[model samples]
Target: QCTVQLGGSDQWGNITAGTDLVRRVAGGKAFGVVSPLLTNASGTKFGKTEVGNVWLDPELTSPFAFYQFWMNTDDRDVIGFLKCFSLLSQHEIGELEEATRVEPEKRIAQKVLADEVTDRVHGETGLAAARKATQALFGGDISGLNASEISEVFGDVPSSELEKSRLGGDGLQLVELLAESGVASSKGDARRAIEGGGIYLNGERIQDVSQALSIEDAIEGRYLLLRKGKRAYHLVAVCE
Candidate 1:
């Protein structure tokens, strides 16, 4: 029985037309139910960016990036997003709303929203990787990441390749390497940023421009992570 139909609110007319056609053909009643299209608090639609739609294809958007996209939801829009996306019951959603109102800093709502959507799209293992990558990015801990996980974490980040031999003896100078790795525009820029105390190597601050990045600095012994600031990251790989 085609007793119920669902679609975006904009498709209400089309939904009703289909229901009517179904009734006439099958001699049975049907109902159409439409929901509002998902939108951010600014009224901008979801699933879109400057480039294109946020696709469900894993190849199009990695699970880690997908989870991050939801995790960055604005506070005002999170509760509504939870209701629309999460499979949680109404009581659970209501509790989350209260928690949001009480302690927004916890980001409990955003976390739940990200977890639910990521799991639905990519599964539990994908969710775990995303969470681990998130922690590694913000918390500056890469010791636990394998080579593939490190690559996944820095997939969208700026990256470069250098001779593995360069990291052998005295290692590469911090300022010159930063510039070459595209973390800074020029050697002078790198030096200034380092002197200003903003350069980070594998999540650790590099206050001295003379600091050498040795082979030991590579995460998993093949990659060096450079950060110009808290968010801008560059990955440098050592090649034979």
Candidate 2:
């Protein structure tokens, strides 16, 4: 007397087969809803990053990282997502549109998009944790986070381990250091990166190629965050 059907766009043929089977065997109309395939701005499949497919589990992505991903969406995608994922009132959405049109840099729409999706996938606590981590990382406020939280926030970045004894010795030159830590390939490459202003340590651009890592610069006594350009991040950890 009743039937349920579930399928993605790719499975439409199979769904029709099921409908045919049902009509012949039980003589009832079959209904179906097909989900469209999702993609990114470049039209690549969604849920994938440079690292790989993004996992839905909180343990895998952390709520903060997930939230940031949504918050960084291109302007073109925001309205479409509002329709697909949000329950916001039409009035609220209209206001968001006005805000976006007036000052896109404020990114009100992107924040709402991120907040809604993060809450749905990871809950409020997860969203909060993610927001906190993002602020600490991007806002240059790393003082309050415990070691575990720091690790969780920077977990996906490229990392290299160094011996604790190495921390006390003469520090490495910027070029040799970056190369030795696997951030760059050679001294020449490191110099090029620095000259181009592509290298940053703890969020500040490093202009001097001769600069070296020192104990005072380390975070929580053992880690350094190195950024290249706008988005490439690498972590250097000193181990005992």
Candidate 3:
């Protein structure tokens, strides 16, 4: 029998039922505490929508994605979020808020919030994995990630499947692939972009317009990551 039940204001009915039952059944005193629902700078209550909900289950939302979600919090909302979701002291949060005000580009507050909240929900090992994935993706050096890690990193990006045989013999031309996979507007655009040194295969810049994707280019011989410019991405899955 808990001495107190704490939940969001929306859970008042549910929590009071438990507290009342404890008093009635065991003649014991129990307390129910309901706090207001946390929200961002916008009035949208957190965790109420499906478009950007972060789930506790790693399958629904990988630890890395969860960490990145917090990392990307808006500057206007980071401090309030830290106060509600993190265990940092008021002094530390004050420092972060000051940092945010003075050097918002550094994203100090968002980083701290992401780190503490991710570590709390996912623990140290999961936090480590999240950090590794974050580094691999943002650093543009994903060669260290295995197939599953690659999938997790680009799971939301547009993708298409290719026959495993496409990589046989001479392998597939990079320009043809860019068109087939819809990474570029057309093969000509893909070629011109390659010439401009903008296309990246598995994270490394590909300057050669003649480059071809071989089995060696595939991570674990299962997937290939193609990047256009800084943020747009597409995944090519090799299948039988």
TM-score of 2: 0.68
Answer with 1 or 2, whichever has the higher TM-score.
1
Best by TM-score: 3
True-structure RMSD, every candidate: 4.2, 5.3, 2.8
C-alpha lDDT of all candidate models, in order: 0.85, 0.78, 0.90
Q: Which candidate model has the greater lDDT, 1 or 3? A: 3
Instruction: Write out the backbone clash pairs for model 3.
Output: none
Overall local distance difference test of candidate 1:
0.85
Number of colliding residue pairs in each model: 0, 1, 0
Ten-residue region with minimum lDDT total, candidate 3: 42-51
lDDT of 1 by residue, 41-60 (tens): 77776544534346778888
Off by over 4 Å in 3: 1-5, 13-31, 47-51
As a whole number from 0 to 100, the lDDT of residue 111 in candidate 1 is: 95
lDDT of 1 at 144: 75
The TM-scores of all predictions, comma-separated, are 0.70, 0.68, 0.85
Q: Where in model 2 is the C-alpha error above 4 Å?
A: 24-30, 35-55, 155-159, 168-222, 226-234
